[model samples]
Target: MKTIYVTAIFIFMAVTVFAQGGPPATPIDGGLSFLLAAGGAYGAKKLMDRRKNK
Candidate 1:
């Protein structure tokens, strides 16, 4: 029983540490993606409006 408890704790710690390893996301990357999406949306809306008006 004691061995099982220790093994469980070790596995939990190992998974938690490994799961979190990654390059942290840069703020600029997020901002650029958001800006691109917003610009695309705006352009699409403008194009649709022009088409509708025509």
Candidate 2:
């Protein structure tokens, strides 16, 4: 039981230290591309649903 508690505490501290290293920056171009892709998917789904109902 004591061993398990120590292991858990060590793991938690390691994760906390690693997480403090901030993530890389995101690209603005990628955001625009993602938005376009999502919009296209939504439009295609709507078209498909409209056709199915007809």
Candidate 3:
């Protein structure tokens, strides 16, 4: 148990110490827009199918 705790602490410290790099930029415009459009189309299709059934 003590060794596990020590290892965890060491790993966390090493990660923090080594993670001082540059910027982390994630471009989410195109993929996010496509995802939103697909979700909207799926929801609209489901709603239409349900309404047609009733």
Candidate 4:
């Protein structure tokens, strides 16, 4: 409970800092690469979860 809240707050702060000009501009991809990477990561996580439950 308390640990979850602390982790959430820390992650929010980290993402906030990252969104504030942390990475260089991607002219060609136009942020599609980020979305693709996130999707792939999410899919991998789901697969891992299913495997773990089985």
Candidate 5:
């Protein structure tokens, strides 16, 4: 469990680094939105699969 938590935190930090932009006016909204949507869709699919298995 400790290892899992550590890995999760590391992954989150890594993603934040890529999400950052150097330009003052740079926009990350588009990619961020896509990532959120994709994450939601993936969670929904996993939930559906879990239900089906049970």
Candidate 6:
């Protein structure tokens, strides 16, 4: 348990020492639209299936 705690502390310190930040960039707009369309189609199909079974 003591070794685990020591190892974790060392890793945290190393990450903090080397960490750096950069400027943000533009985000893609197509992937999310495609996912939303696919999900809607899937949900519609499931709803239709359930209604047909009733």
| Best-first order by TM-score | 3, 5, 6, 1, 2, 4
Report the error of model 1 at residue 31, Å: 0.5
TM-score of 1: 0.50
Clash tally, candidates in order: 0, 0, 0, 0, 0, 0
Candidate 5: tens digits of C-alpha lDDT, residues 1-54? 999999999999999999998767878899999999999999999999999999
RMSD of each: 6.8, 9.4, 9.3, 20.6, 21.0, 10.5
Model 1 RMSD in Å is: 6.8
Off by over 4 Å in 6: 1-26
Better of 1 and 3 by TM-score: 3
Q: List where candidate 4 sits over 4 angstroms from the true fold.
A: 1-28
lDDT of 3 by residue, 1-54 (tens): 999999999999999989888778989999999999999999999999999999
**In model 3, where is the ten-residue run with the lowest total lDDT?**
17-26
Tens-digit lDDT string for candidate 1 (1-54): 999999999999999999896997667888899999999999999999999999
Query: TM per model?
Result: 0.50, 0.50, 0.57, 0.47, 0.55, 0.52
- Whichever of 3 and 6 has more lDDT, that candidate is 3
Q: Give the per-residue lDDT of model 2 (tens digit) for 1-54.
A: 999999999999999998795778877998899999999999999999999999
Q: Write the per-residue lDDT of candidate 6 for residues 1-54, one digit (tens) a residue.
A: 999999999999999877856668767678888999999999999999999999
- TM-score, predicted candidate 2 vs. hidden true structure: 0.50
| Regions more than 4 Å wrong, model 3 | 1-21
Which candidate gets the maximum lDDT versus the true structure? 3
Highest TM-score, which number? 3
Which model, 2 or 4, shows the larger lDDT? 2
